[model samples]
Target chain A: MSRPIYDRVALIGLGLIASSMAHAMKKWGLAGSVAGHARTAETRAAALEIGFCDEVFETAAEAVKGADLVVLAVPVGAMRAVAEEIGPHLKPGATVTDVGSVKQAVVAAVAPHVPEGVHFVPGHPLAGTEHSGPHSGFATLFQNRWCLLVPANADPEAVARLRALWEGMGSYVDEMDAAHHDLVLAVTSHTPHLIAYTMVGVADHLSRVTESEVIKYSAAGFRDFTRIAASDPTMWRDVFLTNKEATLDILGRFTEELFVLQRAIRMGDGQHLHDYFTRTRAIRRGIIEAGQDTAAPDFGRTKSAGD
Target chain B: MSRPIYDRVALIGLGLIASSMAHAMKKWGLAGSVAGHARTAETRAAALEIGFCDEVFETAAEAVKGADLVVLAVPVGAMRAVAEEIGPHLKPGATVTDVGSVKQAVVAAVAPHVPEGVHFVPGHPLAGTEHSGPHSGFATLFQNRWCLLVPANADPEAVARLRALWEGMGSYVDEMDAAHHDLVLAVTSHTPHLIAYTMVGVADHLSRVTESEVIKYSAAGFRDFTRIAASDPTMWRDVFLTNKEATLDILGRFTEELFVLQRAIRMGDGQHLHDYFTRTRAIRRGIIEAGQDTAAPDFGRTKSAGD
Candidate 1:
């Protein structure tokens, strides 16, 4: 472990990102010590048992006391309340960052509460899983992943230090305005997620197509949608509620395009369908060439393709 | 190798499914010899280079002349023409099956062209990749994947033989009526694919969300949709056109459900969104438990999840 960058780190949430951050920080010695707080006693106990936290506090206020870096890793909906509770306790000149998916909401919720001389940087790590909870964490979760930091008007030293911490933990950092981050995330994440959840929900509700049939035949294409739809509900619910405008704007665009293709299907317009489908293929090639996803067919359709 | 199940197998249209079938049949000795015919000379040359076909024919009629089993592996739109071209040339008592994603359309298109004594069984293999063409086939593409056979009054023994051949190629076989097969596939594959194509298209159209950002942040959710969207455009276009009624039916359902979700999001109905999102998760759990997909998180987020 290298010398500590932050004398003390306080993480105020015990979910996937927070738990991961704690472990990553400990592994790299980025913080002298890590303290954490969660709403429930069980999560607090589990965080300590998982050995990611050096101390577990009963409240967010207690957790942030004297900490050099305070990370609000709670859901977006919970950020404002947590910020209010911890604002008075934050150390002067301390850097506060968040791991929320949407940036604008978190910034709006947390920035007003930041004390003078404190740095409030809203950040999002585009890495996670369907699973959640304190137990679902690993140090390598952010390795090679993109971590967007929106440190709106924060001191350069604080932003640089935060970037260093993420880089030290294995992430490539990019800075963007919170609004742009929300728009990009809406297209790349929120809208796609809503579509997946809708498809899976439709499958569940269709009486003619039995659940067993949907599950059994999932490997065809529905399985990928299901994999995405299975992500943590609370986390996603907050994401949609917080990023409402951009997500709705994207949904509108998607609906317009979907109607055109839906009309093509209704009218047997093969050329329109072919043209749209072919155009989309170029983007997939870009993603693969950018090394964002596996080029393996069926995403490495190995022995585990089925049981 | 096992004794040849078919004395000679003719594959019409050497794409991923057809080419894979040829190589798999030869590898497992399920056919004494494999002959293939595609619409283009380039594909025929590629098939010969790939060595999946024992002989490449210039015409479907020439390929099926002496074959005991003829596989109509072209797009759903082309099945009827291929069947008509080879109808009189098909050997007496031969078995004809197809590898189309939709079945009712294929059965309607090809069954009428079958000679009285030649058996025709419609089939849909629930296995493939985004890549197509002769060069894209792999012998193990069908291994451990499901191949749903839509048997419509075909001879019992002929259906059994087709099932055995598919089993020999390492696919689990199931039989269903053609219309039901079409409906099930519309829900499981066609509609999801259409939605994915639309979502990717929407992302591409959004000027505010730059293409670079979409590709850069795709791992969050959009990457999975892109993978599905990358599938062969012509094949999918034909599928949507051929399975129009059933796909249109699913699209209606998806649109209805999506509206309810869109309304909930607009109203900030977190409870409704959470309930819907949570319910979808159960289906994902069922899919995993049923062995149709892996329980891996973020679809087993590879090393490039962030990069």
Candidate 2:
């Protein structure tokens, strides 16, 4: 679809993000050749089966050799080990990047392992689905989605080259500091995910003993939370563990807010609850106005899907 | 779609549920004629503007004058007043129903006002969007959604007639006792909504003074919570206040579960979080398989509208 930005792009982890990037790059012809590797042979086989990559390797070191770009798409907790395994094999002057959710930790885990000539640019694509694994990747996952690039002290040419590649793949690129990105994501993604996991976990525990028929007759609202809770647990567990400070800070604020609302519910303070709900509605409107969210009714329904 | 089930149907309080019922009734020709009433003249005019009813009345008393079926669709808090205002004017042997979320409270509030001959069958249709007011209703709002009927010793024929009307409108009708309905809704809808509202409120607070840009970078997960949080504040406030006992019970469980998760995150217990999240995924899978949710990668996207 366009000129190739990198001669050979290698993905060191062939999971959802890696597979998606491979698909999008191949779809747009942004890379001369895309190669993939996974810790498991089954995933490598799956990647080859999906035909998103030109070749699939069994080892991370094998995958990164001679590639102009190497994507560390593994879990955040696995970043250090994966970087150590693939660092020496990276192509000279290669621009190394990652698609991990947490940035500051990823940078700390990865930067020291990179060779001096190679570039290390960390990014967090603010996009995903409830589904995961190699088969779950889709080419349009990054379209219109925000991809925050945290290129800490990297060569400007290398950062721009990475930005251009992301832009070519249909992502809206933004640059932000790692700490600020972590804090923003704590409020926007991490804390909310923890809360959703908590609620769904509560419902699931109730389903085991209680007679609310929580799953059998869950309404649209609870069902939405279930979808979020159903996301990959390993990734989320790693996320919470790695992004500890920011998530804990947001969670503390959330607990304080929850206690206040809980007291209001207990005291029958309708006005307080009404005021809070009304205030939150404006942020939802802001998200829609900013085109960050779809204005469609979007609760697994037909009429509101296209609106 | 079927023979007219009611000679005349009157909808009280022209909000989302009432306007939607009017549209659905008109869509299926389930009623010979439809009339609507709202305390606000603007709502009455808006109901008339929607062209779903044959007439729009200014008073609840005048609206149910000769109707064979009268739907009390006001907020749960106002059910008693509306019931009392219209009780004396209802046609003898008419079916009086409500689309309130809380069942026991509604029955306690409205049953005493119903005339001896009139059937008081309280109900809750588990179908709605974050939008509200007259303009937010749609003909397919109830399509394939569950409408729980809490007839509670109401005449069998009256309940059957109401079920038939809902069926004609494309909803799956189910019957449950009032207490059970409240408990089920507390677990499935009420607590989920309250948690979403709290999370969004937390996000809003952070966005004001914190340099996080929380709203601007809300990922797919948090955006879903914003939609739920953006629901009509008045309706939700009433839902919590009216369904106090059950909602409180669920909230207690949610807080307990949240504390455990917070502790786990603090202690870096990835296994605990993983097991909890993995267990919750089964409930989501069950919801999807039971046709209550969609498996179509619903991240505010274009797929899964009809699945």
Chain B TM, per prediction: 0.96, 0.95
Each model's DockQ score = 0.72, 0.60
Clashes of each: 1, 0
Model 1 lDDT, full chain set: 0.90
Per-residue alpha-carbon lDDT of model 1 for A1-307, expressed as tens digits? 5788898999999999999988889888898999999999999999989899999999999999999999999889999999999999899999999999999999999999998999988889998888899998888888877899998788999999999999988888999999999999999999999999999998888898899999888889999999899999999999999999999999999999999999988988999999999999999999988877777787764644353
| CA lDDT, every model vs. true structure | 0.90, 0.86
Interface RMSD of 1: 1.6
lDDT of 2 by residue, A72-104 (tens): 998899999999999889878999999999998
Residue B253, candidate 2: C-alpha displacement in angstroms: 0.9
Badly placed stretches (over 4 Å) of model 2 are A207-212, A304-307, B207-212, B303-307
Considering every candidate listed, which one attains the maximal lDDT?
Answer: 1
Two-chain DockQ for model 2: 0.60
* Model 1 interface DockQ: 0.72
